[model samples]
Target: MKDREDILRQIEELQKKFLEILANNPGIVVVNSDQTGQVKETHSTRTLAPEGEKDVVVEIENASATTHAVTVLPTIYLDGRQHPKVYVHLGEATGALPKFKPVYSNPNLVIGASKSHIMNKEGTERFLKEVLFIQPMPKHMLLLIDSWPLFLNHSFIQQFVPQGHKVTILNIPKGGTSLSQPLDLNYNQQWKSVMRRLNDAILIHEIDYKIHVRDNLLRAISQVYWCFGAPRFCEFRRYGWYKGGYLDTHPAPFVTPPKYLFGEGSEGDCTCGEPGLILCPYCEKPHCFICFVANSHRCA
Candidate 1:
């Protein structure tokens, strides 16, 4: 657990080293990898207790995440250029993944399961194999990761990340992940927020399905992540790198989900005056409610 000063000093030295490496090889793909956990969320929508009766739903106080809840682990990476892909692992020793996953439209996502909703060695391998390995060979590769035990397995990494062609692994010091890791600085939170909003919004709209159910849960997960292909997500990826102190210039003039969905300030509106416009899947243009939803836009 490095102190703030130590972390800053280490980041400075690391930035210097990274710049030197880039100065020599500009085509190197720097990857920041990490996993995050999300609980199979039950409705947090509050309801009042009837007279002489207990509340219909009550949340446990400080419930244990590891032992109690059924969680899902989504492993992702941002290469500071493209939109990140997702690898979701079902936890609680549930059976295999959903019989039919909805993420087929995007062949990049890989969904799996583990006893603990945590990224085990196998999960790590699958994540790389499914998400990272298939990428076109770059001039060189730099894997920036947290000091997770499995990530320390040089042997396992060599299985796919080719050792000789300048395969460099830089670990973010333990307990310093949020302070120094690009994916952790802000991107993960936004991703999860969008994921949650997507699920909750569908449920609220009475989508005629149970979002907490395994298949539907997987569907919602896939649908939310499919939007990762949006070019603006790439901007968020690079902005995260700059925020993590890995890049020299800020990825400014950027608008991530948090800004677009909920305006950071005054927001422009369409004729319908809908501030929350959905971007067209094909054109990336903002769509108003009447035009996109009521009128039945091309890409539903």
Candidate 2:
């Protein structure tokens, strides 16, 4: 493991290199985007548990586990322009559908639902076309992102590059997202904090009226979009390649253990955990071959 000082030095070096690249490429701009998942689980600042209990459990009535995937695009151009967009894509779980029709009519705030509660290829393509591509912009745009397959899709890139717009995809260094990616630096926490407050407000309103409906989720999400307009979204774009302060800050350490550990000469072990090793792309942790095969090679 690298020491704190070493990590900080690396971050500074990377930040300088990123800025130099931007300076060399005058027309290119950086737009950082990422997605986060939110469930129907209720979170409150006030606890109802007894004084001695360490855990506070609040029973929610008429509420199922409905997941919603929110994709936030905090665009920060090299020229320091501030126009960000937020997309709330809900999943198609029972009672998870949006009750309010036309959740958001504005182009900046897009709210919709999907069957898997995650952004599919079609949804990603639509976002790039409708929200990103349609916006008035220069000829060259560089989108800095993590290694999400949705962004690296060949067909999507091929389709978008030919429309008089030059789109360049810059994948952040593996395991270096915390230092390189603008959205992960501090914006995601702010967005989630705002969402949690909105959720708590809705929970209180629903309990007061005794109207425990799934629409509460939709209403809360709608209000979040309304509140997190361009100005609020721009606040998240504070950290990026242009900001030298981000490089000076030290990042917190994180480590993930292997999904499955195997003893030497264990039974039913093929290649003794040497061959067919499947690792998580994000964390780079080795997974048990059997578990990976059974679960369709998905990383938890």
Best by lDDT: 1
TM-score (C-alpha, index-matched) for candidate 2: 0.60
Clashing pairs in 1: none
Give the alpha-carbon lDDT of every model.
0.59, 0.50
Quality of model 2 by C-alpha lDDT? 0.50
TM-score of each: 0.72, 0.60
Residue by residue across 89-118, what tens digits does model 1's lDDT show?
A: 766445454445442223435766666667
Worst window of 10 by summed lDDT in candidate 2: 254-263
The sequence of per-residue lDDT tens digits that candidate 2 reaches over residues 227-281 is 3333323323454433434334433331211111222222232333534333333
Q: Which whole-number lDDT from 0 to 100 does residue 138 have in model 1? A: 55
